[model samples]
Target chain A: MPALILFWILAIVCIGAALTMVTAANPVRSALSLVVCFLALAVYYVTLSAQFIGAVQVVVYAGAVMVLFLFVIMLLNLGAPVTSSTKGSNQNTAAVALGAILLLVLFISGIFFEIPGKAVSPATAQAQGTVKAVGLTLYNPHLPWLFPFEATSLLLLVAVVGAIVMTRRQV
Target chain B: MLTGLVAYWDNLRDGIYRLFIFPEYWHGIRLPALVPYVALAGIFAFTLGILPMLIWIERVVIGLMQDRTGPNRLGPRGLLQPPADVLKLFFKEDIQPGSIDVRLYYLAPFISMLVALSAGAVIPLQTVTFRNVHGGLYTVPVTPGNVNIGLLFMLAASSLGVYGIILAGWSSNNKYSLLGGLRASAQIISYELAMGLSLLCVVLLAGSVQLDHIVNAQNTLPFGIHWLPSFLKGSIFSWYWLQSLIVPVVIYTVAMIAETNRAPFDLPEAESELVAGFHTEYTSMKFATFFAGEYVNMLMICGLNASVFWGGWLPPFNCFPFTFIPGFVWYILKVMMGIFFYTWLRATLPRLRYDALMNLGWKRMLPLALVWLFLLAGYSLVRTATAPHITPTAVVTVAHVAPGR
Candidate 1:
């Protein structure tokens, strides 16, 4: 019963922060709201027993990525209160439509999905979320993940080279 | 005084319970849910308790280094100076400049203090081995958190510390504040990679991510070389700093200095350049909290490094009368050594140029850390393959004696 209550509270905070991220006028406020959403999502991950993923989410997204977002927002010389200009009406309409679709998908998935009814045993779930468990799965060739990791590495290398080449000539 | 404090706390707890209508027992059981939080609060109080002492040490050391008497007027050898400083700060007015981001302005220093305090939650001060009144041994680790992911959690929390400085700089909206924030974000993020990699070397040598396992791994000669004569054995040669060529320790030391933004790596808050760096515009208790966070972080990093490099809570050798002393004394001694190292570096070294600092972090420290990690991994792997019997002891029995090492 307590778990149910916590899940609801976290879910509310997550959704509320996500809404605030979209609604906040200042770019920095939006970024701060995004950090709140990320933190709430991390707590949600922990409640579901994905402890390693939860830590990684906070460490990576909220700690590293959002800080960079806030930095960029602060650097942009847009220190004043920001309102969406008339030129971005189309973008605003598209965002609203996409959000509506997302909400619809959530409503449909809530009914169709098993939705935690057949929960894994606590022992197995805890084991599944542990550092060793995640490490083994990620590095295990039998898990079909090694190829994806190699591909990502190769893609990053290419991006680095491309960035250097582009930066060599004045844009 | 200790007993008085205990009695006062018990009275307060009971008074709150009565006021809130909380039952003393629910179905013949006391509340277990509040135990961990209460323990955590104690840990926080302990972490913050040393701030005044730290300030006194830093000021005195720096003064002696520069050939000046440090704050001798406050009390005996300036013992009462920090409290006086604290009082002055509390009485000062908080200044909020116009054209500032008020929300983030208020949020910055609190983030600094919170991250600083929480980062040490996983560090083990002493270990399991106290006998109960029944003469049965009961073992409990003396730390706020002892999770399997202890090291990673510390790394993550330290990484989060960048945000506080960044936000403080940005919200102030001053040119110097912005520069300081940007410098801090850049410097901290650059150095953290090297720090993480250096710590990875310790994890590899111990074959576990847990800090307790790491300490236990250092209790014997390197690779458990039992052939050492009775004259030369345990703790001294067993420490990873000696075993792994001390490269990790060297890299860790430099990275730690940079990570804390102390002098030499303190380009972010350079007084000559940024006018106090990230906290340039902060005043009153907000400023005091930021000041407290820097010293607290220094202690946390020092405690962590002591555990990783030195044998934490372990006497120098088993053959000595050093075993008579409590183990936490050794841990405190090692941490103090680390703090002394910080002061020594600050006194001896001049601040690096911006490019030099970045180059040291990225080109020098990061590559060195990577090389050390690889070397340690290969050495440990070879040792395991050659003689599986000599692997470092990484486990502890729950009912074992009080002194872990």
Candidate 2:
């Protein structure tokens, strides 16, 4: 019951932070709100017994990624009331339309989508989230999901190359 | 009975749990496992309380290194000095600048201090299966909990530590502060990549991210070099670095030093350039907390290095003529040496130029870490593929014991 209560409290915090992230006038505040949202999601992951996922969520998203975002924002000195990029332009209208479509897709998915996996017992779930368990599952050659995991490395390499190319002139 | 408490308590006495935790006696309640928690609080207290001593040590050691007398006025050999410094910081007014962002400015130090202190949660000071006076069987870990992702959890939190400085610099409403905060954020991010890769090598070797298990893995012949002639196995030289080549260790050492913003890598607070840096506007306890946070962080990194590189609480000898001393004592000695290494570097080396620091972190350390990681991974794969396979022979003994809630 206590766990349930905590989960609900965190759920509220997550939604509130997400809303603030969208609506906050200052870009820095919005970024920070997103960080809070990331933290709230991490807590939910833990409560779901996805402890490794929870830690990674915080480390990768809330810690590393958000810091980069904040660094860029600060470097650009964008803390002033964030202006819409060329109001009433064709791109602005297109952006709004795309956002609306994205929101509609998300809302539909929230109602209809279901993950395809059997619910493991709590002990099994706990074991599954362990480092060794994750390693085994990800590395097992027979597993159908291995290709996607391997592709992630390719994606990261491309991103690194992109960054180097962009920064080449400056350095 | 009191003697028994002393024994159990002594085993629990490491850095964080000693100074602040009073270890309340809840004898009347008959709480089955209250002792360890009380002991844990004591450990937290100790970790915090030791900061003043570390600061004093840094000053005196550095002073001696430079051939000067340091902080001798208050009490015997300046023993009372840290407390006096604390009192003064406590009473000083918290001066908020008129132009600063009020919320983040206050939260900045807090986040910094929090990130610094919470790294203590996963550091295993010593193994604890010690029994209490009431004959309860509870093992309190030096870490607060036995999380599976122990090393990752600390790294995760440490990664978040940059926010404190970034926010502090951005909110301080000064160009210098902003510059300091920017430098710190970039420096932390760059170094963290190398740190993670280096630690990845250790994790791969130890076969676990759990810090205690890392120490346990080290207890064997270092790097699983089981083929070593019998006499050479299980000695101090068998520690991980010497066994698995020193590439990762050297990378980790340099990266950790940079990660903590120590002297040579302290571009964020480059006194000659950035004035006082990120904490330029901070006063009173805010300033004090940042100072304390840095020292505590230094201690934590040293503790972690000891646990990861040296055997944490384990004696250098598994078969000990050195058995008279307890595990925490050995833990302290190793950590002190790590601390001394930091001080020695500070005294010996000058601060890196801004571009030099950047170049070393990105151009040098990062590539070295990546190459070392690939080499270690390749070596592991080849060794496994070529190695002799041994089948396990089951010798199971089953014993029935009382089982109840």
Candidate 3:
């Protein structure tokens, strides 16, 4: 019961922070609001018993990625409120259309799709969220996840190399 | 009459023990549920309480190094100077620069202190044994937040600490402050990679990310040489500083010094260049908050080094006299030694050039850490393959499962 209450509180914080991130005029404020949103999401992960994921979420997104975001914003001197002349452009109509499509997709999935696995008990969820459990599941040869995990890592490496190549002409 | 007196003394001892260790209830509330809260408060007090002493220790050590008397007038050997300084900070006029962002400028120092304090949650002070209803003894680590992913949590908190400096620099509306913040974010990000990698070496060897598990893994004969005498089982030699071949420890130490923004790596606040850096515009208690936060961060990082690399709470040797000392005392002593090392380095080395610092962090430490990690991982894999009968993972799982909470 307490966990449920805490989850609701975090849910409110997560949504509020996301809204603030979208609406804030200053780029630095927007990035910081996004960080708060990420943190709230990480807490929600912990409450759902995905402890490893929660830690990774904060470490990767809130810690590393958002710092880079703010670094770029500051480097480019974009902390001041941006004044764009394209405010009433067709981009707004396209954004609204995309948002409607996304909402429709989420609603349709929620109503029609049945999740594959059985609902795990709290004890099992706790067990599954441990570092050991996650490691074994990801690395076990018998499991189907190992190949996909390696492939995703390879893709990330390729992306990194591509970024370096694009940035450094001499290199 | 002597027997009656002895009985009374025994009763008094038992009453005190029960009151502290096995209290069942307190004013209609279950006491066991409150242990985490109590431990949290204790951790906070311990961190804050040590700040003044840490400041005094740093001053005295630096003074000795520089052949100065230090703060000798306030109390016996200037023991009272830190308190005086704190009082002065409290009474000083609070200043806010006219051009600064009011909200974030006010928020930065609090963020600094908050992040520093939060990182202490997962640090295990010591293990305490208690008697259960079955009259059997069980030992549990006395951490405020004994989560499984403690090492990762520390990494996250330390990573978040960069925001405080960056915000302070940006909001100060000063060129020096902005530059300081920029340097801090870049330096921290670069060093964090090496730091995480070094910690990963420990995690790989311990086969667990939990701090207590990492500490306990060190309490064994070096290289598991069972032929050694029993007295040599849990000694300083068994610690990860030796077991991991000293490379990761060296890397971690350098990275940690950089991470904490201490001297030699303290380009962010280079006195000659940046004029006090991020806190140039801060004044009074707000400035003090940033100062305390830096010291607290130093303590937290040093405590981590002590626990992860040095044998935390474990005696240098598992001998009769050494074992007689309490575990937390040993832990604190080791942590203080780490602090002394910090002071020693601060006095000895000059600040690195900006480009040189970046080169050391990225071009040097990052590649070395990666290579070391690869080598260690290969070695561990080969060992596990050869010694299939005695799998380390199996042992780790069994040990972890047996201590179910």
TM-score leader? 3
Instruction: Answer with 2 or 3, whichever has the higher lDDT.
Output: 3
Error at B12, model 3, angstroms: 23
Which candidate model has the greater TM-score, 1 or 3?
Answer: 3
* Candidate 1 iRMSD in angstroms: 8.1
Candidate 2 local lDDT, B95-139, one digit each (tens): 999899999999998888888888877777675554456655454
- Deviation from truth (RMSD, Å), model 1: 9.0
Ranking by DockQ: 3, 2, 1
- Order the candidates by TM-score, highest first: 3, 1, 2
Worst 10 residues of 1 chain B by lDDT: B394-403
Q: Give each prediction's DockQ, rounded to 2 decimals.
A: 0.30, 0.47, 0.53
How far in Å is the alpha carbon of B126 misplaced in model 1?
1.3
Please tell me which predicted candidate would have the highest lDDT against the true structure. 3
Off by over 4 Å in 2: A85-119, B1-39, B130-141, B222-234, B382-405
All candidates: TM-score: 0.86, 0.85, 0.90
Order by lDDT, highest first = 3, 2, 1
Point out the higher-scoring one by TM-score: 2 or 3. 3
